[model samples]
Target chain A: MSEMTLVEAINLALARAMEDDPDVIVLGEDVGINGGVFRATAGLQTRFGSERVLDTPLAELLISGLCVGMAAQGLKPIGEIQFMGFLYPCIDQLVNHASRIRNRSQGRLTCPMVLRTPHGAGIRAPEHHSESTEAMLAHIPGLRVVIPSSPERAYGLLLAAIRDPDPVVFLEPTRIYRAAKGEVEDNGEALPLDVAFVLREGRDVTLISWGAMLKETMAAADALAVEGITAEVVDLATLKPYDEVTVLGSVAKTGRCVIVHEATRTGGFGAEIAALIAERSLTSLLAPVARITGYDTVIPMARLEQHMMPSVGRIVTAARKACQFS
Target chain B: MASKKMADGGLPVVARFEVRHRNYLAPDGSINRPLPAFASDANLLVSLYRAMVLLRSFDRKAVALQRTGRLGTYAVSLGQEAVSVGIASAMRSEDVLLPSYRDNGALLWRGVNPEEILLFWGGDERGNHFSGPVEDFPFCVPVGSQAPHAAGVGYAFKLRKEPRVAVCLFGDGATSKGDVYEAMNFAGVHKLPVVFVATNNQWAISVPLRLQTGCETLAQKAIAAGFIGEQVDGSDVVAVRAAAEEAVAAARDGQGPRFIEALAYRLGDHTTSDDASRYRQEAEVQARWREEPIARLRAFLVGQKMWSKAEEERLAAECHERVEAAVERYLATEPRRPETMFDHLYAELPEVYAAQRRELAGEGDV
Candidate 1:
């Protein structure tokens, strides 16, 4: 186990994936020579050569479309969209072409490719850099969405996503790249695409979160622990096929829930989890399902981003509100 | 159901005798011109003929399958089977074929297994694509989308200096799409080694010939895109083969891309979802049927003594038997698992989904 930041964890995971699978290729703007703007693919091209680590054209559609052929012809492509907002142009290929290829082929062709996009608002990045629109992706039936919190989880979950036999949208929380550090197990063995990881055990309110905001949830839980509150934290690694069993079981035990994310409260995944908890674990609940989330507004560029992201205070307030419920 | 005379409609009723582009007999089953099988062997001719017959059979079967709810809405290639097969015959073993959804006939000619074809007709992935030396592409359902892929692959060939050419087969309806124009423009500008074969059967779903374009002919559209263009009689296999051969020659000889339009007819329902009678007058269908490629070719072959009536009947019987056996084979195979839906979704599975997949696995195997 080695202590490292999320960015380091991602780089380690990529190194391992590239080492293990000759078919696995990394391609994006600046991903080859510059190791990507975020340095997520640092040393990858150097280690694997420029052929496997491609520096593609800036056109998103071509980047996405080229992967379809490459993957079809037996290459595992990992496409980096740079930011969550930049993924829009490639959505048509992902949603319309990649996701449905297997079904459209009546089970003949499978798009076993992975896409990584940096999501969420926190460090005052430019517009479209920190946006997270996972709900629209949630509506797609065939895609699997994954979001990891700490560097350790990023390495493990990313390895698993890369090995899964479907198209995976690996949503990286750029905000936590430097902030979240943990011991990473860089073993090439990947986990499943539908399991949720439990970060902490508690008998009080259940704290459900993913991506970068998971740090705030943990911080909030620790703060609450000083006040004699026990919180159960669940880090949702994969989003589309979310671990309902883990979440529902925790909700049934804790009997309270607070969903957290950097995305806006309106129509976020928080709403879905909240509704599910309210419907299933309502009888055992000690509080209404609360959510500590960002406001329903566009991600502001720098300077004003502090007002947009859900903070540790927000999670604590939501937890307190949940514990006070009759 | 057709009018006694062709003068009733605004369509030019070009007489077969005056139709200068003949390499086969007229509709009355008499040879009108000598067949130009210059570069082909007898084996290829028989293969092409057999393929054209299978195409007709498969189209009928797919239409029936769609009607019975066994398949999704399909695009049929009924009247233009000869052109599809003849053009496909021109492709070398290493050549790549890019075809629209309506080009099922071409798929058969290109050697996609009949059983696999049936699976595609039944909406199974096993039928979607066959991985083999044939190098044929899966049907392009989005109309003109495959043209760009053809150009891309062709560009790769040019880059690699491979002698192979990419044959892009689409329809007149697809010509109107922006992707088609863009792909052709790129292919021309880049001098990509691509042969653009337009099967101008003259309908964009329900749109008529006039609605397809005001250009005098579909081949003209290719001229504007900076490629040599030619219009040929799609019903005549000899003419289609000659045109395709010439176009492919241009692409192979570093002359870049060329467009060849095979003007033919679409003589069936678009798919099970379509009812042609609702749009076209009964007389129109009958009028189109009079120039059926198969009947004309059969007559021409008989006149030249190269083909026999007994041989034709025997070939039809063999085709029917082979198709039936393929269908039987598909029936024998077990139904695909439902989780195959998840197969190949990603190259790797995340740790988070293990438990859920376990649950799904425990529930029952699809």
Candidate 2:
């Protein structure tokens, strides 16, 4: 077991996957000699050789399409788009080819590839650098959208994403890439996908979130504990094909749900979770479900970026409202 | 001003490049020059002629089916049969083909059944599950997107040290897409074993070739990627096959990627949904029909005494019979189960989707 940040955990997991499978390849812009902009792929090219860790030309569509073709040819490719803002070009390849290869070919071919990108705002970067549009990706069928909140989940979920038989869009929370650290055992054990992890069990309200919002959600749970309002925090590791059983069960027990996310509120993934609770666990609810998320406006630049992100105060206030209702 | 200075020795010439054009058979079905070695094989030339005939027959029937409201919107390889059939004929069975919607001729030559093609245009997923050349990609509807896929396949072969090559086919309009350029550039950088064939059919839906690109020839577009690009007489099967064979062999021998631009005309509307009369003139279509691939190949075969009038009639009848049989089989296919939509979505359906699949199947409250 080693204490590492989320980015370091990602590097460890990639090294482990490559060491285990010869078919595993890492390719992206600056992934070879530069070791990635965030150093998530540091020392990978030297260790695995330039063939396994390739630095492709600056073309996101080509990178994604390459993964589709390589995956179809039985090579497991993990492609990285530098940022979530630049991942739009890859949506064409992901939606048209990677997401539907198996169904389009009727099981004749499959795309076992992973497209990893740093997601969410709060890094105070330039325009189109900190956007979190997980909802748009989650809307794509035949794709598993995974977001790991901590170093531990990042390590485990990344391994699972690489080994999965279908294509996966693994969104690493850039806000917590270095902010969050945990003891990640390099034992090659992958956390199951399409399942949620119940971080803190409580009875008053369920604080549901994924990715970078988990940090605030956990902090809110701790703050709410001081006010005698115990909150259950559930990390929705995989957005698409999310673990409904765990979410509904948590909502059923708490009877009050507060969904938090950094993405804009309208059409956000939080809306789906809210609807899920409304449909499945409504009768058990003591209060109406609440969603604490970013506004519908564009994520502002550095000086005002913090206002655009979901803070622990907002999560705490929402949880308090959910607990105080009727 | 810059060119004038360069001419006055301000800048020395660093590089010289030229694009080659190949034409084995003239429009009049006469041999224009010495033929390639493959053209000497009478049986092979006859097979190429037969494949073009079969593709034309299949295309006609498909259009008729779409017109009769029996099939979905279909893209026909009407006049460009040589471009696809010729290139496919040169490829080994182990090679991968990333083909566009109009490359049904190539798919057919690669052993995909006519019924499977019909099933695809007929709006069924199972059609893509090709029993022949299973590794080859399905018809790519998006323009120029499959170019990168071919590069990736080539990269895989190179990484695995395999002698196989990947061939990608697209239309003239696809050359303008950034995806195609990026793929070619990447292939050039890596020297991947890839062959890009652009069928210059002179039309992209309602757009014309003049508006599609500013370059004189689409083949020259490949020169920017640091590779050899050649143009071929697309209506002449022998020319296309010879060029494709050379390109495929060069790529397989680790000589880097090669690009071929085959000049043809869209003898039909872009698809059954399109009406060329709105954008193109009838006279142009008529002139192109005289240069269509099937008739040109047939004329050459007949001139060489390798084919006869009776043999022509028999081949046409056989092609019609085969197309009709495929249409019958396609029409007889049963619709897939509604729940099967979730079947191939993944290797194993996640539990989160299981209930939804069950609900779609009308299994209540599972």
Best by DockQ: 2
The 10-residue segment of model 1 chain A with minimum total lDDT is: A65-74
lDDT of 2 by residue, B1-366 (tens): 344568688677666678899998888798999989988798999999999989989999999999999899999888899999999999999999999999999999999999999999999999999767989999999999999999999999999999999999999989999999999999999999999999999999999999998888999988999999999999999999999999999999999999999999998889998988999899999988898888788788889899999988999999999999999999999999898989899999988788889998999875
Query: Best candidate, lDDT-wise?
Result: 2
Q: Of the true contacts between chains A and B, what fraction does model 1 have?
A: 0.20
Off by over 4 Å in 2: B1-5
Candidate 1: lDDT over CA atoms?
0.77
* Candidate 1: tens digits of C-alpha lDDT, residues A1-326: 88999999999999999899887888778998799999999999989987678776565655665565445444677889888888886776677766776666544556777888898877777777778898778767678889888787788888987876677889998888988888887777676667788899999989999988888899999999998999999987778878888999999999889999888878898898887777667887888888888888777778989888888998999898888887
Screening candidate 2 with a backbone cut-off below 3 angstroms (N, C-alpha, C), the clashing residue pairs are: none
Question: lDDT of each model, Cα atoms only?
Answer: 0.77, 0.94
